[model samples]
Target: MSLTGGSVSVRHPAQHRGRSRLSPQAYLATTGRILRQLLADHRSVAMILVVPSLIITLMYFMFQNAPHRPGAPSPFNNACLIMLGVFPLIVMFLITSITMQRERVSGTLERILTTPLRRLDLLAAYGTAFSIAAAAQATLACVVSYWFLGLYTEGSPVLVFLIAIINAVLGVGLGLLCSAFARTEFQAVQFMPVVIAPQLLLCGIIVPRDLLPDWLQWISNVLPASYALEALQEVGAYPEPTFVAVRDIAVVVGFAVLALCLAAATLRRRTP
Candidate 1:
């Protein structure tokens, strides 16, 4: 309310609202702001940079003493390769979901949406920032796994890194989409089991997806993580990027794009 003489005046919340266009200036500003926030949070930085390597280190010790048969690969190394992809995806998903939820709960997202800023710009800015974090996380993890843990792959490490980065961005997209349905940070956390658990169980990591029932195979076919794991497996089995590996990577990138677009479509100006 504004005082004019002895009277009070009120304005409608939507009075000044208009269709916000995408602006490079606004997008860069938002991206820079979020990047600064991410850097300032030491815990998040550690989680993104340190936790994956630590987990790999622990796995190394856990399987160091296991008996190995002649002419066989280390079980620990095999598991590490799988986890190299899984860890970044899960970690990125958790961080992105909770962080976005916090913005809504704290009214930051609401206030921003009220401005002349397009939803796509906001979501794209968020994607770019988290992707940078994901790249750093994947790089550190790959270094620890390949250099320190002796994790071996038949294919080039560069291809593995490429797949890892794509999976991390996939997580970011899904997390952004899921956050739209959550009312609180806790609710966002709850979505992990709902969104990720099923994929883990059926992503051909535990059991070969093709060996499972027809219905189960069909389900696995639809999950993006299944494609990610398949791509990693192809890399492990081949010395170069094969046609199948390239196809899987493309599928994952498509899914991530779809998820981000849907999230933008569902974005709300305020929490209800």
Candidate 2:
């Protein structure tokens, strides 16, 4: 009986090893599970999708009523561009961190680790799922701003849409990285100041990077948000894709990939 049991265990592991590569079905299952979880949680849905839209809408109305000098750039376009870069960062960062922390706290992550799931598979699923949500959020925000609030851009709307999606995906990557360090939802939220606020301050939204103190300008050079906002502005200002716009977009996407890789490396099977 002992020999038989030992042989069965060895064969089981060998069979598992033979199938160790990431399975598409498993990846899809994980993605679907996350999407369904988001759907089931009305508050999560509201926070992730609705709240950003509401804020953007309010900003639109406020700027819409403001007076503009003849031939001056419209405040609507300015506000839309800022919101395009910032809102997704805020929403996706909060949602991804909190949701992942919840899974860690609930032992779901640990249980998943005991199964055949690969870390890459899990992270890729998350990245894909969140990117989809980010795309939707970007589309809705852009449509509302352009169609209803009368925001205008000289650049192609397709470029604007693509940049917005990339920015949102960057948020997801940063959120995942931050979540790995946080033990609770509150700690995850606290990361906003550390991971996000600095980027916002130095990303040339308020003061142009060149106008900042030399050291601060140096700091802005390394931050992903700086590139993202720059890409957004470039696209808005240019009618077609420019070399600078493409370079900035590439940088932002690179940062997203790096952060996600780091997140996968830091992910723990058990809560510490």
Model 2 TM-score relative to the real fold: 0.93
Query: lDDT for each of the candidates?
Result: 0.89, 0.86
Superposed by TM-score, candidate 1 places the C-alpha of residue 94 at a distance from the truth, in angstroms, of: 0.8
For candidate 2, the lDDT comes to: 0.86
Model 1: colliding residue pairs? none
Give one digit per residue, the lDDT tens place, for model 2 in 1-272: 25754643345774785478877888889999988888898997887677877888898878777888988777877877888888888888888988889999999998887778877678888889888888888888878877877778889887888888888888888998899999898999999999999999999988999999999999999999999889888888888888999999999999999989999999987568
The per-candidate count of clashes, in order, stands at 0, 0
| lDDT digits (tens) for residues 1-272 of candidate 1 | 65666767665656545544767888889999999999999999999999899989999999999888876878886888789889878998999999998898899998888777778789999999999999998899999999988998999999889888888888999899999999988998999999999999999889999899999999999999999998998998899889999999999999999999998998875558
Q: Candidate 1 regions off by >4 Å?
A: 1-20
TM-scores of the candidates are: 0.91, 0.93
Model 2 alpha-carbon drift over 4 Å, by segment: 1-19
